[model samples]
Target: MATTVRRTSITLPAARLGPENPLPALRTPADPHQVDERERVRFPPGMARRIGYAPLRSLLPVRRLDGYDRHRTPTDLEAIVIENDRLRATVLPGLGGRVYSLVHKSTGRELLYRNPVVQPANFGLANAWFSGGIEWNIGATGHTTLSCAPVHAARVPAPDGGEMLRLWEWERLRDLPFQVDLWLPEAAEFLLVGVRIRNPHQRAAPVYWWSGIAVPESPDTRVIAPADEAWHFGHERSLRRVPVPEWQGADRTYPLRGERAADYFYEVPDAARKWITALDGEGHGLVQTSTDLLRGRKLFLWGNGPAGQRWQRWLTEPGTDGYIEIQAGLARTQLEHIRLEATSELCWLEAYGPLAADPAAVHGTDWTAARDAVSRGLEAALPRSDVERAYQAWLGCADTEPKEILATGSGWGALEVLHGRFDLPGTPFDEATLGEEQRPWVELLHNGRLPQGPLSTPPGPTLVAPHWRDLLETAPADALAEYHLGVAQWHAGDRAQAVRSWERSLKTAESCWVMRCLAVADVESGHPKRAAERYLRAFELAAEDPGQAHAVLAGLAREAVPALLAAARAGDAGALLGALPVSVRERGRFRLMGAQVLLAQGEVREARAVFDAGFEVDDLGEGEETLSDTWFAIAERLVAGAGPVTESIRRRARAEHPLPDAYNFGL
Candidate 1:
């Protein structure tokens, strides 16, 4: 009769999100930090200012989670269900609070792309992400670092006197706390989600929020939005304005029309109702509309190119239909960041439900008519004023404290709560949730210094936020405190101070972890040789510990050998690779590096054989072209045979090689 919330479990063949990589990710993201200022597009000056604001220099303090492998086993995942008569929504609290499945009950149709398996891929900011359903992306560009992370979930009062599922987490990048509240009213077709992002700091913060909804895609489906044009961004790394629905001699609205993956940010007029839809040939599909504050909408598709098709298979289990993303955000494009003022929060209400439009109109050549028909349908189903009214109703209920705890997320939020003395009512990051990871930081907060530990033992995770950095700065100097202090200074862009702190830490104790930190600084400072030397030394020290785990050895090698190769010390890299445990050297990442070493040593054929033998880097970063690049390099060497190569010769080499799909993650 009314909406209900319940905790449950779903069994799926899921890959293990293994332990986080102990190596600090010192390099900045491959993606550019800012939108190219040269691009000519007309935007209100206020909007333009927000777009060019603060962007992340590096995802520091957040380490890579690349220890996972491709092997998966049937496992039970905790889920939260919110249901009424017409809709049933299943939320996975453990995995970024992703809405795993949304069913339109009457027709027995799954409205979202319910992923058949929990396969983790290297798509997020922190290297591990998954495909399927609806995901809330926060923090900076790329998929949120929380893609496979747990978010605190609890039961709260709903606007319509029903139960609401609240999901909240401390977004590390911008140091903000955000919450997502999901509920459905009695007999309502649409699911209501109220989202809020709070800026607790004294100064302004750059906020990025994109609610990515993955709907089932098909050859006949066409995405429609209330805009005549869109800002198109493609694999070519450029952005330009293009007509909506039809572009580049094809109806770009259809996900399969293009040959490569792309993002289409619809230029929704300020006064227009914010909505986007993807309906099939028969005119029934999902529509997502949000209140005006969530101003931007987008369509992202893995087009019908070979790489795109291959990527779809790589991200999921075999024999399943793929999906396209319809996303909503605060800025006009994903590249831009919106400025959230100090002590203020941004709130918006979004509705997702099935929409039925005229098949002829939806699939017609007239883009305006198709979009208008869908917008009118959305209005008839749930009017803009009603959505606004719902937001007002939600605000009153949003502060109502949780009735019960459904699930628990990371202790990072609670650590922030304790540090800042935040007064978050409805979404409480309780002190009880603080665990082993936050234990040291908790001590640093209540006590004066970071607890000292043996140099042989790896350091715990670092905190680089201004508040934590201040504490680390005031703490008594020691190897433990100085090492973490360097990380914080580096995050703040004080490279000189970071180097000084690490060098001083070395006097107190010799640590591979601190040496690795210094090596990262060396690399950033353009001293590749110095970096290589430090990396090699770090690995040597780490190797001296006979009782160390294989993973530690493998992880250190993964960082060191790359630096050695970068410095043109391939011989040293080869020796390091040889020193690895046989099992470690055989891993895809090390094997790939080994092939590079062979190529450098003039053993081109041997390098080529490694590619021919076939291997997969399960932890490869998204858009990393190393696999295909190395493949082509070997092919070119074999073709030239110690001769001077020309462009045509390169072309011939590639023609002969014809990189396999397994290695072609180029886009």
Candidate 2:
């Protein structure tokens, strides 16, 4: 079926480019309603600028009164014009500072802007010299540091007939002392930004820091970091990876198939690579970590997450872009296999910024030499090779599983160490496969021993008792009654309940069983604030009895520092200080944390005094070596400003002999 086609030329009148009359029909529908709600309408000059100057599209504008939804329409947009200058003032309290503000705007929604200090007042659309831009709400609470106040957006027209337009502007803020105004243009294509740091307190303040960039999830976002290696820690039976999904489709290795909960840490030591790209398959994508890239600086990575804990699978898979994260710390592999002090120093990281720059043009410092040294130091510190050799030696001596299991546990100290690190891999024996004669074999397998058979099954019942507590709650009690009950609660994910149950078990007639349960649960659920107390309590109860002490102490040592770090980041000073032992060495960390709080509180001299006094404390274990590095970095940052402190710390720590390993905490 062929159809005839006719062509005719029609001419339209030219019009002035203003808010009232835009381009003729060659342009998109001038009336906004003609476009679908989701489909954005486009106009002249601005549209050309969006396509030619700013390649990216801005989100539709909506008033705050509309709630957390996207902004749509020019009328909904707002710029905080200061109504009163006297009403807005800054306050420097001890804990991070405070900003108080009040303003009015044409937009219907309430703007909750917060910062550590420097509050901005809102003004309606009036043109005023004291105009304070939009307020940024930081954290769960709306506390934000008013180091940078972003206002004014130049709207670029959309080319593809979409509602999204590009914004271009030049911003200047007070927080960044040495840096000049950043060159972020409002056109969707360019974002030149500047930072401002305003410290009102007499004593210099340490700004607790992390950069947050929020971009909508789209199919175009592809996360990338310039790093040589990635590592992660064990979480339950799972193996976690720090770089997250290395490539787009490496989902097979993850535990929960199709589960898109992506969260992990990463470390990128290479500064040569500037920006990590998140490409939208549709040619519109975002590049991040560019602020550092623009300045030719390395990304500083710091985060507190699961370390040493084991889980079933490492990453979560999202078919499309759900979220991609890059962190500045030990990757899951390094975090798992190497100590933080040794492996973590080499990392540089990046986060969200933009995607338009030549990788070669980005200024960078070569960190390979330092990274290699860090790698070697970490390998030197690891017990992996030694453990492997020990396992080989033990195998050479004993051919029989039954004899080997008994001998290893009841063997020499070195052999026991070997046995702990290298466990034989195999599936657990099914109850159906066990005969009366095989009960002893089953018992050995259940208790985390290598079994001998064509079917060298490692019994899950014994090794994973805690994971199955819920199933066994109603089961009858035997010698393992209280122990099994506590394990069940632990396995069932009631950590608090598991701890309580384990404590209850200690009062049972079977002290040995109760002690074992208590030891494991205490580490898993004990709060850092409660850790030292419980550990001491557990030790005292087990004083005449040593089994509980060994197990609980090991667990406590492994879990305590990390728990303290978590507590510290979450702003729990009591938990941070309380986790430390009463000994002088532990007091160093307590004092250091106190200093951090003091610094946050704007008590510079007092905080310094606390650090100075605490550093004099006697060393308890090699664990303090890592703490020393943190202190050194903090001191140097305060004294010399933030730069390369890793080298200084490494040199200093090495000058001190016998690095802390007394704690023997793997994380």
Candidate 3:
């Protein structure tokens, strides 16, 4: 039978992706995780261009989705299945177009690690993501924002005459339109994927694309890539190139051999074939290969460390095998971004299939022979010429209109297309897809004035893109317009003008949003006390708006109470905490914050009760240390008797008051 595409499903226990926080995330990570100045000079020649680009300043237009918690129930996910005689690929269309499972029909082998549960964690850029399957990482340095979000999915004409599943989205962080087309040819062993990223704008934009594949890991599993050296990054602040396969007397190829979690960005030769594989001791497993344009390949190991093991266990069910990542990207390393010129495109073809090589050479001490064996196996399984041919064939029909539409994603893409007059040939963001979120901006774009909800209503999302900023700047000086204009200005790095704009908005009418914006500015200006006062005012304003969503109020409280505690206004913090409904206050995060507020007020006994009563932050981030830090602070306060908190006192407190396992979320 010819290749066929059909609707499918997978039901698993998944956490509730709670409502998005209705607050603008106006901050970005300030730390620079780059190679040391001395080490920079030693990097490969002409690598600076890729190493530096415009890192994001704020996720303004995309609100924070931190409200999700760890609650699980059986969930049914709609999927798309594309199968030929040899292989079957099931894609979760709603879940970032993730390739949920790829099984070889002949051998009955599952090529990818299929998780038993769809547990949401804080790994994604939007703060809610689950491990397993294959994820397409775009946007900035970390996981793509669409990790848990849906994308436009449709059925398009495949190169082999059968239909292919197409997934497209307008990536907002970089303002680029991209498409991923998956097709399995009749009787073919490999699943072919053609990806295209189009920059329809008039200026150059930084582009980042990485296809991440999670493969099952075992003690005998070894990841093979055609590279003699690699760029190694660890928990420590350093990125240095080291010998591949064997580093520091140990074979780094095995995922479980290391002591700590790390990423090894392989330095594949320009002339070498770009491919990576994770094979068992028998040298049979999955292999991912792509065209030369997709140059970078990497191996991410969770390693054998306690925190790493804990993280592994946390992502899946109680009894499940651990997994490692074999990824392919555009640049030599993910820390870098390849620049795509205006109105240009970055397109490539990738193939996933089963590979079998000589186990003796693959697992042997000789790295060159080992990689060579896998490379040859890839050439035999699916040659570079065949991949190029497939790319060309796909390009011929890339713009073929979808014969049928299956699913729809965010309306942001449609809004951008309408506003910018963008013509994406292969990927269409139809006007029919526009929804409520785009309604306000659409009105503002058509009419010259920005729309404002009632004063009793909380401020909604902000559109801080450059185009929206220009539009807002020219529109009448409405208070709401000015507030959003300030956010846009701040996003563009014009701090002084932003502050002035906020001041102007405040003069027109004081708003919680404006106050919060000013508070962030105040903190940046080294006035934490004034910032605290502004946050308190914003929290009070939040209280009066009963129409505000519960998530929004909790988000405001989360932001405000921390600022109050930072300013040592423990009484105000307690009052703000008390103002919340008991249901919201009893959540793990708020309870932890309650303990911090109590400790700040020297009420150690009351704070201890918070930790004594069991609680868990379901959405705890991968490396966040807030829970342990709060517990240690309370422990220190328990022993601090009208004395300055010293290192010795801290050590003694930690030694005597061991952090309870329930509350210890340290990484």
Q: Candidates sorted by TM-score, descending order?
A: 1, 3, 2
lDDT of each: 0.88, 0.27, 0.86
Candidate number with greatest TM-score: 1
Best by lDDT: 1
TM-scores of all predicted structures: 0.97, 0.23, 0.96
Span of 10 residues, lowest total lDDT, candidate 2: 59-68
| lDDT, residue 192, candidate 2 | 20
Task: Say which prediction, candidate 2 or candidate 3, comes out ahead on lDDT.
Answer: 3
lDDT of 2 by residue, 486-596 (tens): 544554456577566556555544343344345444444545455444434433443334333232332333333344344443234334344434441243334555565
lDDT of candidate 1 over 475-517, digit per residue (tens): 9999989999998998888889999999999999998989988
The alpha-carbon lDDT assigned to residue 544 of candidate 2 equals: 38
Global CA lDDT computed for model 3: 0.86
Q: What is the lDDT of candidate 1?
A: 0.88
TM-score of 2: 0.23
